[model samples]
Target: MESAELRELLTPEGVALLDSLPPYTSSTDVLKIVAGLRKDGYSASLVATVLTQAKLRGKAVAKFGDFAQRMLFTEAGLEQATRLPVAALHAGRYVRAGLTSVADLGCGIGADALAFAGAGLQVHAVDADEVTAAITTYNLSPFPEARVSHGKAEDTDLSDVKSVYLDPARRTSGHTNTNRLANAEDYSPSLDFAFGLAEKLPTGIKLGPGFDRDLIPDTCEAQWISVNGDVVEVGLWFGPLKRDGITRAALVMNAEGLHELTAATDSTDAEVGELGLFLYEPDGAVIRARLIGDLARSIGAHMLDEHIAYMSSDVAVSTPFASTFEVVHEFALDVKVLAKELKSRGIGTLEIKKRGVDIDPAEFRKRLSLSGKNSATLFLTRLGERRVAILAQRL
Candidate 1:
């Protein structure tokens, strides 16, 4: 956001106008709103700013929930900010570790800072963008002890800080619609500088789930966190923040509850065996953390292929770490044969899953000529040396 726009947004008139707006939706008559606001003598810039904020708030519900209504956001900031629930989890770690004074370097829109303050910890939220820092200041206004500063994450003074949390920027610098940066070294604060601080103070670094595990420091705990089945981030914790004997972990959160699988070191992949009565698909975070062996052991499952992440077992095990399906029948990879079988079974609604295969599910679905009232999951994968499709039902 520009300084002029920030000035207007921080004003009482802007605040009241934004608060008065009805909840925004895709169906909202944006043109009507603009005409009405302009007819009321509001400046074009103010109208645009408030409307953008209203729209962003509508989209931010998935991350901030109700708190989004009272917050400000930049396109990039909202997109990059940590989800509120996940930020709370990060704050809980600090509180549990007795690190009450932590610096949040590269704090985007102050999501973590908000959680830190809400958890009753002193927060020092720093960002490279001056406007973002100003907006963060407004967002953290309720907490007198929470400080917001405009500065480089690597250069920020941390003499008084107890612990540190860094979420390096992974996109080109901008307040809106910025392009993503792929190289780890290109991230703001740079991986080198961010990882160097971990050697000194207790620290937690938030990274993309697909970040190179080989690049991870040897001493820190590597934890991949998934929320509602989506692996959101992989956090590396060092020093006092690292859990004892838990260098590798997968934290899965869903309707059932939060489930964690941790190991002191990488787990050996489960031994391969013949496909069994049930197939287990480990959560993405589990696979990312390289803890599939632990999950397999927990559920009495064995790998279906030595190289594949899929596992199976004769016993139907109930666990949140993996989704289980009961096998019905296996068919040769011939599409006509499978289509005939599915049609005969009256299978209409199909949930297609595949691994170790090359086929588009959507295109393949069309070829199935599906027309029925029943639903079933079809797993198209290879077993040993044969390509087969297994019909299964959720257990």
Candidate 2:
């Protein structure tokens, strides 16, 4: 059914009717429902409609809170669905820089639209899917002035857009085919196409955290955004209005968490590698910012390799900017011997990390007979000219 029809069916009475059906007790139940829906040719809109209706019928709200949370928001958009702090931050930055209007292409569910409107800027919210347009319209109900339209990203006119905001459809509707945008060329509304639109105005593109850095435009500024410690999204900024280079932003959001960041460019000094007593892995946001070298310098730590993301130092840094761990043991070589030694040490629990190593961590852990009492991290990597296993503990 169309979103309008779905909305009509969402009336309290209609919702109650659907809710009267059997409730899913667990993730398995939800999965089974999804599978059955898929088999029955149910669309994403239909699935969400069913789920929402189920929730409205009081589908064990307290007991299945996690499942409901994931189903309702995380799988939908969660905070991203609302696009509060991120959009607010972006809008505030641009507003400070004298930007006034935005063309939010692919404005799914109006998260950024509402943010832009709330920021007191005129916005043109566009989405290709009618259902998404409806969702955006509903989400932006409070912001009636934000113009929501349905059209392909390329078809949307950019005449009044001072800063074009693009959030490409990174995945298909079913949440399958995660690599949908693996190639800029593969994007239905391709990145190259978005870049073309961006070249005409100051542009911001909200991207997946796992996006390939090599493909991003050289002139654009890349930002990795993390909320409380989890990296959420990566945004690329373009035009003369933006600060040049990569910026890592650590945002603590609760409608009130203080935000701090480090914005560094490719021109910054190259970082050197040194093995210290402790090692650190920068948060996903920091890594996405392409400011690993800058962060290493700030922490007075060194990199494991110029290209690698790990940082090391003997000095303990209490900052939450990166995940810190202490190196408990190091081996020059020997997967088999190392495994045997760990097994003998009553180390049955293993968490393996690798950089430039092709071995599967799970398979390697399985090769060793590990027990639950001893949990250790095995870093398979190259330091200088040797393959080594460095055991580490969270610090």
Best of the candidates, TM-score: 1
Compose the digit string of candidate 1's lDDT tens values, residues 157-238.
9999999999999999999879989899999989999889998899999999999889998899999999998999999999
> What is the model-wide C-alpha lDDT for candidate 2?
0.68
Q: Per-candidate TM vs. native?
A: 0.96, 0.77
Candidate 1: worst-modelled 10 consecutive residues by lDDT: 299-308
Q: lDDT: which candidate is best?
A: 1
Clashes of each: 0, 2
Flag regions of model 2 displaced more than 4 Å: 1-12, 15-48, 52-83, 172-179, 210-215, 228-230, 244-264, 267-274
For each candidate, what is the lDDT?
0.93, 0.68
Candidate 1 — which residues are off by over 4 angstroms? none
Q: What is the lDDT of residue 126 in candidate 1?
A: 98
